[model samples]
Target: MPEFNAPLRDMRFVLHQVFQGPALWARLPALAGTVDADTADAILEEAAKITGQLLAPLNRSGDEQGVTFAAGEVRTPDGFKQAWQTFREGGWVGLAGNPEHGGMGMPKMLAVQFEEMLYAANCSFSLYSALSAGCCLAIDAHASEALKAIYLPQLYSGQWGGTMCLTEPHAGTDLGIIRSKAEPYADGSYRVSGTKIFITGGEQDLTENIIHLVLAKLPDAPAGPKGISLFLVPKYLVNADGSLGERNAASCGSLEHKMGIKASATCVMNFDGATGYLVGEPNKGLAAMFTMMNYERLSIGIQGIGCAEASYQNAARYARDRLQSRAPTGAQAREKPADPIIVHPDVRRMLLTMRALTEGGRAFATYVGLQLDTAKYAEDPDERDAAQRLVALLTPVAKAFFTDTGLESCVLGQQVFGGHGYIREWGQEQLVRDVRIAQIYEGTNGIQALDLLGRKVVADGGQSLKLFAAQIRSFCASEPPYADAVLHALGQLESLSQWLGERASSDANAIGAASVEYLQLFGYVAYAYMWSRMAAVAKAQRKQEPDFHDAKLGTAAFYFERLLPRILSLEASIRAGSSSLFQLSAEQF
Candidate 1:
């Protein structure tokens, strides 16, 4: 089993040092009574325990057993159903949801920690909860009041699960090509008819009811994404008394056998004239579904961070304990048969690199989560707007960088285990396989890059980029002990941003082609800012606990010396964008 002790410590540093959760919580009325340093700490401790004890024990078993479909029902791997029951019983489903709708109203900063822990423990089990949270968030924000009243509590409590149905056989990222149709009925209901593919947790007997947020076009709707609308199509319709009524026409046609995260139960769903009610409005579903998609993007990034941290722990431990070769330097443990692998420079490099990236990724995710919270809960419009821009700018980075690093780190971990990693039992190979999907799902990293460059950056005239750049500058200008390194990293980011801004001016395709690489550069720089701030704070509190503060300084130095230098490579890619990206004609294939 993977140990999560270091991860928990890093989570605390991110929440308190990077984002300053306590101070921010003080400003929001919604978080007044529920969150504080102590409360947040308590939540982290409990979450760590649950993830390390309950979830980690089953991660391998779940991966090995996966879920079996028999006679129209899906049987999740052993202990998953029970784990899910406990997840619901603990009110975890609503951790970042609306309190009025029976959600815990916990801020996203706090909620993101759970998201990472779930990824660390078992990405498969985490899917059921993650989907429910996102589904309810969209519903709470855009669904009818009646729908909110009926479904929010159950969904938040985990009595029910939710699924996002957007992709079909003909359409994946190109929703404009989707063929799902909605036909109106007399009782203000609609019949949803289509088949949705790659729907995670789409069909399972884990809960009493499953709520599906389906996308379909109306009879007289316009063509393309604009014509799409979201619908609340439950497997079993809820009565006025909140009890299950007749089963809707929707059914799971089959399950997808995927490369990884197999316990998630991806389904091929067939909606045979399923009775459904519109979520927000007709011919406006795609816009509304973006709400869920955006949330999922960030959540997926958290998955990457957790998996990387888990991999780092396993690899670090293996390197420290495994003794095979003598130390490069004079060995302190000379009495032993051979020095541990940790004594090797390259092995130490890998472990520290994993640590630096994983920790930086955690800080980046929490910072984004905090901005999201402020965007929704801040009293001032200016503050809210500022936070919103950061959210939009950093979201793609969070999704792409964290997951990309996650895959890299997991692979490095597997390499550390040598031949044993190729086998599943040592657990290194499973982590690699499990984290791979984070890069592919919730919109491919390539598509997300396009969204960033085309929509958020160039199309917006680099307004979001400017706002974030200004934020980084403000931090760099501060009188921190390590101001030189922080300023250097921040300056690199600014230069990269400038280079991107210039290249994207005339070339429309540049944004799409350069988006992923730029987004990663953006993430590294932003995390550098965070690490600098954290180290400064830790230094200020040197009298309190030098270990924590010293760790912050060391990690910040590691980021500056090692990770922050990657911006030069990414900048080149962004600058080279559109030329090579567009060079390939259809015949090039």
Candidate 2:
């Protein structure tokens, strides 16, 4: 079986040297004095231990055993319950939750590292905690004070798990036409009725109760998405005194047999007039739910990074140990009958691609986390607004690009293993199966691309894109290594954005036709920017940590030379426009 060890050194490098997370935290009034460099490092160390020791061992076994569902109750695999108890006691579920509600109050910058570790160790195990953390965020952000007082503490404490119920039987991406209904009652509560599918942690044995944040429409609400509202529905009703009351009308109808992450209970949840309270304003559920959805979008994106990291580790180890053939130039290892596969040029290409994409993605994720932290905690209004715009521009790119390349990286890792990669025992196949879902879920990558191109960029007249470009230009002004390459890529992105904006005026279908490719082009440019920043830091600090910084510089060079040029093909495809795509009619096939 493959093993996972958190890349603690690289993680620290990104957090401290590249992003300067501790310095930013000290400047934010809400985060200052909460956590410093030493404390954050200790937290990362402890997280690595828990994930590597407790969760990594269970990954394969959990997949083999999976989850058992009987009589409407779901039980997790062996050792999961015990592990959950230990994890809860450690207060890991609420690592980035609000401190006023019994959470540890860590910044997203530090929390993202822990999240990557959690998913890398075990994707299924991570979902239970991730959902709860996202739930706590939504409730704290939009829920009433009474609701927050009642729900936030338990959810953050891990005594109760959480889930977001959005996809219905008929509605997948078109949430505006959802059939779920919320009827207002006289006692200031509502009766929720709906059947939600693909609900993760909707029913699990790890927690005492499951808190579901369901989306439904009120009777007097407007049409389409504006009619939607958010509700807090728990499996078991809670009394005013904070004790568990009678069981609510919510129940798990069944579990879905999935391709991967089988240990997670993908539930078919049925709500039959379940007692639920309104969270935030009525007829504003989609907005309220976006609080959780955006968080989950980024969280799911990290899921991709985690899987890729684990796959790369196994493949790299295999390359070093598994001898295949002699090097073409000469025999590097004369003692052995054949040289290790790492000596092969093709194998080196695959490994370097994996390393470059994974490492570049790590830097990018930390950068996004910094933007998130700045948006929430920064004292200056202008600074916060700028960070918010960047977050809006980058979140979709993070989700789509990370997973899109994440799958590619995993496939490359598997290819390095040759025949053994196809076997189940090697664990490479499982990583491939598990990471594939990140591209589909939390709003499919296609939808994410459309949001990035149509809503974030073109809808704002390319202002958001320009704002982000200016940031990159400011960095390039310092003339760092690969600065010209990064600037050139940024220029391509700007020209493409203007082209799409002009096309949108004349052609209605132009945005959708070019969205996916546009997002890809945008992602490559953003990663190039990330690589440039890291290269600058690595050059300045190479003497301090020669081996680590040298590897970083090498990977950055590989990214610039070999990977960044893919944007050219993407640019050409985007310029082709919607004419080719619409040429074929429905009957032509």
Candidate 3:
């Protein structure tokens, strides 16, 4: 079996040396005294232990046994319930939750590292906690005080699990067409009747109760998405005194047998006249749900990074130990029958590509986490607004780009093992199977790309893209390592943004036609910016930690030399416009 040890040193480098997370935390009053470098390190270490020791052992077994459903009850695989108890006891579910609600109140900058570790150790196990965290975030952001007081504590404590129920059989991406209905009652609650599909952890044996955030349309509302509303519906109703009352009408009809992450119960949740309280205003449910979706989008992106990291570790180790053929020039291991595959140029290319993308993605995810912290905790209004805008602009890229390259890296890692990678015991195949879903879920990568190009970039007339470009330009002014290359990439992005804006004005289908490529181009440039920053930091600190920092410098060079140029072809594809795409009609196929 493959092994997973949290890359603590690299994580520390990103958190401390590359991003200076502690200094930024100190600047934000909400996070000033909450955590420091030592505290963050301790938290990360504990998280590593729990994930690497407890959860990782269950990853392969969990995938094999999967979840079982009987008599309308969903049971997780063996050892998961015990692991959940330990995980909850550690208060990890609410690592970044609000302090007032019994949470530890850690900044996202730190919580992101823990999340990566969770998914790396076990993606299936990680989804349970990830959903709960996202559900808590949405409720805390938009729920009433009474609702928060009643639900937040239990959800944060992990006594109860949480899920976001948005997709229905008839509605997946176009939520406006959903048929779920919410009927108002005299007692100020609504009777929610909806059949939501693909609900993660909707009905699980790991927790006492499951809190579901459902989306439905009210009776007297306008048509389309404006008619939608968000409701807090639980599996078991809670009495005024906070004890569990009779079972609500919500029940799991069945669990979807999926290709990967099989341990996670992808449930068909049937809410039959379930008692639900409105969260936030009616006709604004999508807005409230976006609070959770954005969080999940980023979380799913980390899922990609986690899987890639795990795959890279196993592949790198396997290459070093598995001897295949003698080196072209000479045998480095004369005592052995043949030199290790690591001596081969092709193997080196695959391993280096994996390392470069995984490390660059880590830096990029951390950067987004820092923006989340700044957006929420910054004292200055202008600063907070800027950070929030950056969050909006970069989120889709983070989601799509990370997963796109994440899958690429995993495939490369699998290829490193040749036929062994195709088998189940080695665990490379599992990583590939598990990470594939990241690209499909959380508003498929295609939707994410269109969101980036149509909504975030072109919708704003390139203003948001310019805001990002300005930051890169500001960094380029300092002339750090790879600054010239980064600046040139930034220029290409700017020119492309302008070109896209012009095309969008002239052609309605231009954005959709070019969205996926546009997002890929943006992703490459964004990672280039991250690699540039990491290179500068590693170059300056190479004397202190030669092995670590030198490796970073080497990877940064690899990214700039090999991966960064992918944007050139993406740029050309975007410039090609929608004409070729439209040439084929619906009848052509």
TM-score of 3: 0.99
- Expressed as tens digits, the lDDT of each residue in 145-207 for candidate 2 is 999999989988899999999999899999999999999999999999999999999999999
lDDT of 3 by residue, 151-262 (tens): 9999999999999999999899999999999999999999999899999999999999999999999998899999999999999999999999999999999999999999
- The worst-scoring run of ten residues by lDDT in candidate 1 lies at 1-10
Q: lDDT values of the candidates?
A: 0.85, 0.94, 0.94
How many times do residue backbones clash in model 1? 2
Q: Give the poorly placed runs of model 3, Cα more than 4 Å off.
A: none
Off by over 4 Å in 1: 1-3, 495-502, 581-588
Per-model TM-score on C-alpha atoms: 0.96, 0.99, 0.99
| Number of backbone-clashing residue pairs for each candidate, in the order shown | 2, 0, 0
lDDT of 1 by residue, 200-308 (tens): 9889878999999999999899988889999999999889888999999999888989889988899999999999999998888888898999999999988998888
Q: Against the correct fold, how does model 1 do in TM-score? A: 0.96
* Model 2, CA-based lDDT: 0.94
Q: Lowest lDDT 10-mer window, candidate 3?
A: 458-467
lDDT for model 1? 0.85
Could you tell me the lDDT of residue 207 within candidate 1? 96
